[model samples]
Structures are given as structure tokens and as C-alpha cells.
Target: MSNVLYEVRDGIAIITLNRPEKLNALSIELGHELAAAWERFQSGPERAAILTAAGDRAFSVGADLTDPPEIWPFAPGVGVHVDKPVVAAVNGLCVGGAFILVQFCDLCVMSETATFVYPEAKIGLTGGLITSLAARMPHKLAMEFMMVGEPMTAQRAYEAGLVNQITAPDALMDAAMDYATKLAGLAPMVLSTIKRHVAEVLPKGPSEKAGIARRDLQAVRESDDFREGTTAFREKRPPQFKGK
Candidate 1:
């Protein structure tokens, strides 16, 4: 079965991450498929898009540790230019790279059980996700997530204005679709123009901010601490990070 699935109906493109057993973890193939799916949505007749995942366990548990994807270590929407609105239907445990998607979506509908987390600090790397989160959320809250690496519950996300709506797990898709349909009903050209204008007026989009992030993250990746962190994670032991 395909790791990513895409379909369009009633002017809304629906994209689903299909790896439920792994909590929809993004492997290399899945990341490429997801990027392609988004491109298809943008080029197709769809006026809006809904991004979701199969299964009740997770929207995505983030990147697959066993074999990470070569794509940007952030949300697909971050570096890509998609003029149409996109809504995220977060079901459960959304963490690491997955949290980037939640941050970039135009609207977000999260399941009551869903949680958002950024564990980059724990892994000894940082950049794009941090930059994007700071842009979308309040400074203090973004710092808490990036620095502490704690999970934020759906209620907290909603209260913080990070998500548009929160609902029972069973109602997540319905709520997301409702928002996407509303967006699709608007005048397409006007909607696209407004989206473009907003992006232009914003201080920076992910693509614009990514260059610095990539450089900084590359430096981190070369650090002995990064090696220690990954090695410890794989060996199931606490990382003994030394300031190196």
C-alpha cells in the first residue's frame, strides 16, 4: 500500500498518511509522496486541501528513526509554495517533524487526544521548526516547546491559538473538512490572492528562513553532542552530552 494517499472531491483535496502501524511515521518514501501529493493538490482543480492520517493512534509520530527521509526536516508546507488554504486534521500524537505541519497549516482541527511536541533540543539539533514555531506562536510559548521539548495537549494548543478547533477523536475529520469546504467555497482567485498577499507581508516564510536554519543545523549535526544523542537514543540509554 502507498504510504501517502491523495484524492479530491468537491474542490477539496484530501491527503492521508497511511502508515498506521508506525503511527504514520514519515520514511523517505512517505516524505517524497507527501510532497508530491501537495504539488498535485496545488496544480489540480482543488481549491483547498485537508491533511490527515489514517488510524486513531497518531496523525504522525514524526520522522521514522530507523531510516529518516532526505527531505527538509520540517513541514512540507514550510518550503513549498501553495497558494490555497490547507487544514490539518490532527488525530493523535503529533510530534517532532509532524508539529511543523500543524504550525504551517492555515487552519488546524485537533482531536482531543492529540498532542504536539518538538524534541529537537533533546536530539541536539534545531533550526527550521524553531523558526517556524516562533513565527506562528507567542515567543514565550515557542521557547518553552523548543527549549523544554514537552508535549502540548490539544486543549493547551487551542487555548494558545495554535489550533482553530478541537473535537473528539471521531469528530476530528468532520471538523477539518467543514473548514476546508468553507475555504473551497470562497472565490478561488480572491482566496489565492489574499493568501499570497499575507505570505508576502509576513516577515518570513519557511523557505525564506530555512537557509540560516540549515546552516546552523548542519553545524549541530557535526557536533559530538549530536552524535552522542543519536547514539544514546539508538542504544536506549541517556545521552551524556558534554559541551563540545
Candidate 2:
């Protein structure tokens, strides 16, 4: 079976991450397959896409840590540039790279049991992707999720205006598909144009970074701070990030 599954029902394209055993981790193969699937969906008869997972457990546990994908990472429908909407059906833990994926979606329906977090700090990685889209979320909330490395429940995510809807696990896909279908029923050209305008004009991140932050990130990435952060996490200790 394919790691990435794509099927069209009515005018909605349902894209499922088929690796339930691994919590639908995005491997290199899955990433490339997903990219291809997104392309097909954009050009195919489907008017919109509903992204989900195979199991009841997870929408996606994010990128595979043991064997990470390439530099680009696994961004659902990323780079496909589909004009139609893409709605996320988050069923469970949406962490790390997966959190970033949901941020880029036009809309999202998160299961009651779902949680979102950007815990790259625990793994010696940075939230480059999340940072790129941080402007979509509230400044303080986004910073808390990234800096603290704590998972935010679906309800909290919705409260923070991060998730579009919160639904029971059994109804997660249904809710997402309903939204996608409804979006598909609209005038495709107009919807496409509106989405383009928002995407092009929206603020993805800070326009100009403070010189201190830039220097800090540079020094941290190269210095012992980053490594110490990861090591501290693995050892279950708090990280002492020195600005140096």
C-alpha cells in the first residue's frame, strides 16, 4: 500500500497518510508521494482537498526522526500551489513538522483528542517552517508553543484561533470533508483569486528581525546552546540557553 493515499469523493479529494503504525510519520518516500498527490489533486477533477490520516490515533506525528526527510521537509500540498482549499483533519498528535503543515492549510478540523506542538527544540532542530508562518497565529501563543515545547490541546488551539473547528474523533474526517465540499461548491475562480490575494499579502513572519535575535540564532545554532538544549531535553532537564 502507498504511504500516501489519494481518493476523490464527490468534488472533494481525500488525502490520507496511510502509515498508521508509525502515527503517519512523513518519510522521504511519503513526502515525495504526497507532493505528487497534491499535484494530481490540483489538476484533477477534485475541487478541494481534505488531508487526514489512516488511523484514529494521529493526523500525523510529524517527520520521522530516525530517518528524516530531505531539507525541504514534508509539507502537505506544499509547493503544489493549488488554488482550491486544503482542509486539515487532525485526529491526534500534530507535532513538529506536522504542526507547520496544518498552519499552511486553508482550514482545519481538529479532533478532541488532538494536540499540536512545535517541539523542535527538544531535537536539536529549529522551527524554521513554523517561524515562517508564525504571523498567522498570535505572537504570545506561538512563542509559548515554540519556546516551551509543550503540546497544546485541540481546545486550546481553537481558543487561540489556530484551529478552525474542534470535533469528536469519530466525526473529524466528516467535519473536514463537509467544509472542503462546501468550499468546493463555491465559484472556483473567485475562491482561487481570493486565496491568492491573502497568501501573497499576508504576513508570514517578522518583516525585520532585531539584530540581537539574528545574532543569537546564528550563535546558538553554531555554539553549544543548541546542542545543550537537545541534550537537556533527552536527559529530561531544563535547557539553559545562553544568549552567547
Candidate 3:
């Protein structure tokens, strides 16, 4: 099944984390599709995007246990440079790495049922990308949220300025769409400029920088020239580089 679904309404793109059967876990397949969806949003005519999940029970429960994914796909300002405004409509559990997804968004309207969790510290595992949280919210609160590994309720998330607003589960998408619609009506160039500059102002964590570097390195690795060079070496012949 396709793990991500992209739709557009009135110039606003709606990207769904569609793995309800698995609670929209960030599996490898889902990660690739989500990355493609972000690329589409960057190049498509859509003026803004609303990121939400398929189920009301959870936006995402973090990485898939048996099949985790690289951090690039989930990254917006980091690996994926998306200038358009993005809003997160989070429902229930947004755990661990999943919380970073919400963090990268421009604004968020979370459901009252939603709770944020970062259990990496307790699990003897950690993804340093979560450090971006400090740049998003109060440093002390971000540190406590990551180090303590407790479930942050919707109200606390709002009070800490982690989330912009909180609404009923049924009203989550409506609130996100409202934000998207408003953004779509604004000047696109101005919005993109401001978004890009804001990202520059924010301090990027180590893993976040690595994610960006990975994107560049991955392109070269996947390029046709890379294949040609390898094949030529095997044949003991001069390689014809296309500069791809």
C-alpha cells in the first residue's frame, strides 16, 4: 500500500502520513514516499501544504522497529529544503523521531488527544536531530522533553510554544486547512523568502547538517556517472563522465 497520499485543494497541498494500520510508523517505504511528496510540494503549483496523518489515534509512533528509515525524508529545513509554508495537523501520539517532523513545520494545530513523546533516552537510543527542538522552543523545556522522555500533553505543548494551537480530533484537519488557505492567499515569493531566511537564522544540529550533506552525497551516488565510472573501472577502460 502507498504509505503517503498527496492531494491538492484550492492551491493548498494536503500530504497524509497514510499508514493507519501501522499507526503511520516511519517505515522505509513511508519515508521514501514522504520524501517524494515533499519534492512535489516544492515544485508543484500548490502554494502551501498541510501535513496530517490517516488515523486519529496517532500521527506517527516514530521509526518502524524492524525497518527504520534515513532522517532525510522527515526533514524539511534540514535535508529537504521546502520554502513554502507547512502546517502539521497532529492527532494522537507523536513519538520520538516523529516529533521532529512536527518541529520542522512552520506552524502546527494539534488535536487535544495528541501527546508528544521522546523515549529515545530511556530506550538507550537517540537521534541527535531532536536537538533542533531547542531552536524551536524554550531551551530548558526542550531539554527536559528530550532528556526526561515523558509524554507531553497537547495543552503543555501549546503553552511551551511547541504547537501553535490545539483543537478537537474532528477539528484538527479543519484548523490546518484554514492555515493553509490563509497562506495560499498570501504572496508566494514573500513567503518563501521569509521562510528561507528564518531557516538560516535557526541553528542546525549535527544530525541535521549530516542529513543535508547526505542529500548531496546521495545524489552523486545515484547519478548515472557513478555507475559508468564503476562499470568502466571493471572493464579497465576510460570512463565517459556525463557530469550528471
lDDT of each: 0.81, 0.78, 0.90
- Per-structure clash totals for the candidates: 0, 0, 0
Strongest candidate by lDDT: 3
User: Order the candidates by lDDT, highest first — what do you get?
Assistant: 3, 1, 2
Give the 10-residue window scoring lowest on summed lDDT in candidate 1.
70-79
The number of the candidate with the highest TM-score is 3
- For model 2, how does the per-residue alpha-carbon lDDT over 1-244 read when each residue is reduced to its tens digit? 8998988898788988899999988788888888778778878888899888888877788889887774233353234456778999998888787777678788989999988877888888753656755577788888888888998999899998888899989888889888997998999899889888876776644422332245345545778788888899999999998754
Candidate 2 regions with alpha-carbon error over 4 angstroms: 71-78, 205-244
TM-score for candidate 2, please give it. Answer: 0.80
**1-244: candidate 1 lDDT, tens digit per residue:** 9999898777789999999999999898888788778778877888999999999988998888897764453354454557889999999899787777667778899999999988978887544544656667787987898889999999999988899898999888888889999998999999889888876665664554674366456658889999999999999999999966
lDDT of 1 at 1: 94
Off by over 4 Å in 3: 223-244
RMSD of 2: 13.9
lDDT of 3 by residue, 26-132 (tens): 99888888888998999899999998899878999999988988765557766677999999999999998788898899999999989999998988877689998
